[model samples]
Target chain A: MLSDLYIPGASALHRMRPAWKLALLFLYCTALFVVSHSLMLGLGLLLIALGYGIAGLRPRHAFDAVRPALYVLVIIFAAQLWLEDLAMAAFVTLRLIALLMAAALVTYTTKASEFTDGILALLSRAPKWLPKDKIALAISLVWRFIPMIRDQFEEVREAQRARGIERSLLALVAPLVVRVLKSADEIAEAIEARSLD
Target chain B: MTTRDIVLIALFAALTAVMAVFPPVTLPLLPVPITAQSLGIMLAGGILGAKRGALSIILLLVLVAIGLPLLSGGRGGLSVFFGPTAGFLAGWVAAAFTIGWMTEKFWDGLSFVSATLICVAGGIVVMYALGIPGISLMADVPLSKAFMGSVTFIPGDIVKALIAAAVMVTVKKSYPIIGQAA
Candidate 1:
């Protein structure tokens, strides 16, 4: 499920260095906060939408990016309208939409490996005692384990359901945690055996 | 940290991410959905102790910042850090740390009541303390209003804390991990 997020493309946004795109994203988000005018925020939203087109991503893709935040945005809009004025509500909503769209564009264009490399480049400047290699390993291991754990969770859920135990939180979680911990111990031993530390 | 420590940190981070994959339990009156992800935070700290527990959350956030769709409802990326709920997300780190520290301190006489108290202190008090201000700042709402909006979440969070406490006590008895390693 995680792997399917990145759309393959050779567009300019895709070709740009991950580090530069990340820096621009930071600047864009900060700039959106600074420019409070509604007109400017609307223009920023338009620009980000156009970015999706330039990246060879469909309009649906752009919508997908902001879809998850739709609930929160709507609630904020209603709250701001109640608390302040219509203009203020529109301003806050538009600003958040623009920020979400811009960030999504970056994710749509960049690959996970490229993002990890850019992060490593940034972390390289940290203190030597930070164990950069170990940090990288830890991040990769997290990526690896996410799907594994999700599958394990599914397996445990199925097993519990078969036992006619539905809607019990403890029944679902306790076995999963026990299995995860047991697997983790084996994983640690395997990593040690390989001298990966 | 030992290799096992690093692995445990990664595993806990993965566990948290997995929790987000479950559909959130939505209530008719509440604006926000109740999520299982916070329960994962409590478990991480109670089982892994202070340092590794906190580190696991940091690692999870780093992945989120890099645009992994790890958060509930498949939301992630740099924008999440700027969202209205960003404060709650940030607070998870401290929440885990507080729970881990307190659990360790109470390890000698840890009980369901004590564990639940620790989870409430960290998961609810500390989380809302940071989260309310974040909503005020980002949504441009008054602090009092922000606090009012968040009141809907307390009952759900308390339930999560109870579940976390039960799970921790059970795990500690069956296969203890916290303070077992340096």
Candidate 2:
């Protein structure tokens, strides 16, 4: 369920430093809000889509990145359509899609290790006694276990469905918690054994 | 904190991220969709207590800050903070902390009903307190409209709170040490 957007490639975007990619993302997002016209936002979306092409990424990858936000985009579109004009609704939705795709491009190109290393380098400059190692490890593990926990969730969800507790949100809770906590314990023990502390 | 605390924090952070992968239930009237992520936040606090619970969410935010698509609908990056949902994103930390703090203060004598109540107060009440402003400011909507629009989230959130409460109670009964204070 954790859709890691990193599509491995040697594109220029991938070659760029993660920190710089982040800086540019901030710049792009700021630019998105500043440019208010529908035409400009539409052009912005086109420009971003072209960037995906230059990066040797498929248009489908960009679409997949923002796919999960389809519902939210529809909501934003309908909300603006109700509250304002068609032009404004299209402007807002296009901006959101452009922004999501831009961010996704960065994630799709950059490897997790490169991103984490960049983050660690930045965090290393923080004040002393910040528990930099622990924080770094926690962040790394967040990426590592996200996919695993996602798989576990699917397993638990299927089991719940099989037991005919499909509609009861409350019923799914206990087993999911138990499984996660059990894994947490095992992971803690493994950490101790490795003397990572 | 000890190894166990660090590990539990990471695990709960992962849990929070994983919860976002579940497809959100969108109510047409509200901008914010109903997500299981908030339930994970409640569980984090109720099960892990204040310090670790808040720290867990902090770690999750750190991942988001670095542009991991870990939120519901695969959202992340600095831009997300500039979006209408930023307040609710910020509220997750506070919500988790509030539930954890409540559990720490009252969970020694925790009851099924009280646990559910704590989740409601933190998960819904505190979440809205922060989120309404977020939507109002970022989305450029009126505060009154934002508040009214957000009322749709309550029914789903209430169900989530009950689930979180029941999960906590079950965990306490099944594996008591899991929630025992570090």
Q: What digit string (tens of lDDT, one per residue) describes model 1 on residues A79-180?
A: 999988998998887787787778878887887778888778877998988898789889989989998999999998899889987456777778888888
Interface RMSD of 2: 3.2
Which portions of model 1 miss their true places by more than 4 Å?
Answer: A123-126, B23-33
Q: Candidate 1, residues B44-94: lDDT per residue as tens digits?
A: 898899899999999999888877888877788766887778899879998
Go through the candidates in order and give each one's DockQ.
0.68, 0.46
Residue range A115-188, candidate 2, lDDT tens digits: 77887897899899798888878887777788888788888789888999754666666787788888888898
lDDT of 2 by residue, B93-138 (tens): 9999999999878867887899999999999999899998976665
Q: Model 2, which residues run further than 4 Å from truth?
A: A1-3, A34-47, A143-167, A182-186, B20-35, B64-84, B173-181
The CA lDDT at B62 in model 1 is 87
Best candidate according to DockQ: 1
Provide the lDDT at B6 for model 1.
Answer: 91
